[model samples]
Target: MNPVSQSRQSAIFGKRKEPHTVIIARGDQIRHFTVRPWIAAVAGSALAAVAVGYLLATSYLVLRDDLIGATVARQARMQQAYEDRISSLRAQVDRITSRQLLDQQMMEEKVGELISRQQELAARQAKIGPLLDSAADLKTSSDETIPTPAPRPDVRAGLDATTHSTLAGFLPDLRAGSANLSAADNADRLFVSINQSLRSIEADQMDRLKSMTEKAYRTADAISNALEGAGLSIAKGYGTSSVGGPLVPLDQSMQFDAVVDELDEALTALDTVKEKARQLPISNPAPGKQVSSTFGVRKDPLLGTPALHAGMDFRATTGSSVRASGAGTVVTAGWNGGYGRMVEIDHGKGLTTRYAHMSKILVAVGDKIEAGDIVGRVGSTGRSTGPHLHYEVRRDGKPLNPLTFIKAGKAIAGLI
Candidate 1:
């Protein structure tokens, strides 16, 4: 092959190739550089790595400040959110606590009110007890039975009963939760208990008042019955007696006022009956005397003749006390023809009683005397053989049987 052709062939594809060289000449000083293909490739790779590293470093330097600032801002936002949540939670807790305090105060006030009501009921019960006792002691026997009051629903029913049970059931839980419970919870429980107790007291008071009213009615009825047995009418008008009073206002419950009115009416009835009984010639003039002679037709002891005896003769010793049979003013207290040292009492309502055959007269005319008052002493001073007292019961100047009055007085005495 020609040299030029061989050189061109070597440059393109010949195996015997010259080394790649870079030459530089400066004033007869020359430098040559040879580089293998693998070395060039390694050098290019190193240059690319250094270029990439430079770019990465420049980018990091530019963005580091912004990234740090953004991170700090995000952290600050999270912290602010956490603080806001804590503040909201604190406000809710404060509201709950304030509400609990208000509730506690209200419950305490309710408890106080219940206590006051309870005290009032207790005082009423105490006052009623004595009235009942007085009515029970009154004596009047009858075959008829007194009607009992109908059963009433308890005042503690409905809400009161529920509150009672709830309080009872919650007691153990309250005790168990005492450490964790707020003041409001305890106050609520106390208020409920007081209210329930007050309700029970009110129910008891109602029952007691009913009983008292019934007893008073029975007593008044008994007195009325006694008056009827004595041949007197309660419906008749009382003579020359007048009484009146203004009705005072009472601040109380409706039920309480009703009961009190009933009791007062019964008491007034009893007083009226008692006054009527006092006016009648019912009491004994001589308590320790036996009847020597009865009223009506009998053989006269002094004259030994059949005659009508207007009065009963009571056997008594001389100077024995002779008492007035009824409450009245004395009309006559002096000696008489047949009855020596006699005394006559003019009871109201056209009734009169006489005590005759007395040894001495103690009461004078116009003297006010009550039943069983010692008006004179007994003696057989005129038309009598032994010491005795003659007692007579008259209505409108007409004689009546004295035995009836005696029996009626016995029945009425216990009530008075």
Candidate 2:
């Protein structure tokens, strides 16, 4: 109804609003301000936007600092993990290296042991070689001296080709120290083969030693038998003088040494028996001489009567040489009662020989003489009907058959 009231109503309801007025009083001063509704609204909104922007900026700064810290911590953790992994890998490498060194050392020790065994075998061969040579020599001598139906195989041939080849192949590899861990299994097999070859050589050497011992015993027995057949007693023991030493026992652990000792004993026995056979008078006194009268009961040429003859009469010239039958010392070298111009030789071991009816005596009493040594000259003297020499063999002052000695000498001529 009124104009002021109408204008207020229009301003409240109109699309284009009116401005408002503000009054302020301070002491005696008074101020009035006008503000539009749209302007106030825009100013409030701007203030709200500025407050939001400040809050957002503060939040962003604080969160950025926290994110930087978290990133640095994560990087540190990753670095620590990598360091641990490196340490573990290093430990594994060290373990592998140690294992390889241990394997190499063990391989070296095994190879050294094999080398020592090879050296021992070589020493054994050195010892056996001499024995084999000696045995071969003995066998050869026996073959030449005695007659046999068939020739025997050589004992030295027992050393086979396998033994030599195995030794030759394995020794160089061992000496060079060329074995490695990669070839450990192969080295073991080769060592086994070499050991087998050494054993074979040892077995062959043992067989040869046994054979030599047996042969020596057999030879000694044969010599004893021959001597005994000729009415000669062999002494049980010989070499009583200049043969004294300590009685050292043999080493039982070394079988080869014991066997060699046994073989040497057998050879010594053979030598002793051979020496005894040589001492006996077993040779012809006058070689190529015709025997006119034999030993035992026969007709005497001087008396032409049945008598006992104690010697053999050899038909020879007046100046024929008469030699000693065996090695001895001359006991009588002068004229005797029945045997004129005689020479009596005293061989050791209760044996003696007599050369009777000699023209001249060349050997004197107590003169040393050997078999086939000229002692006198033959002649028909002192109860001899013609120029003939009488030869007699006696044992312990008892007469024996001279033909027995002569026959025995022929049988063992090659052996002596």
Highest TM-score: give the candidate number. Answer: 1
- How far is 151's C-alpha from truth in model 2 (Å)? 30
Residue-wise C-alpha lDDT for candidate 1, range 231-325, written one tens digit per residue: 87666332236878997676557667678667756666666777777777788899967998888998887788999899898998998898888
Task: Write down the TM-score for model 1.
Answer: 0.69
Clashes per candidate, residues 3 or more apart or on different chains: 0, 0
Candidate 2 residue-wise lDDT, 215-306, digit = tens: 77776666666767878767645334576689877552277778877776776776676666666788888889999889999877668799
lDDT (CA) for every model shown? 0.74, 0.73
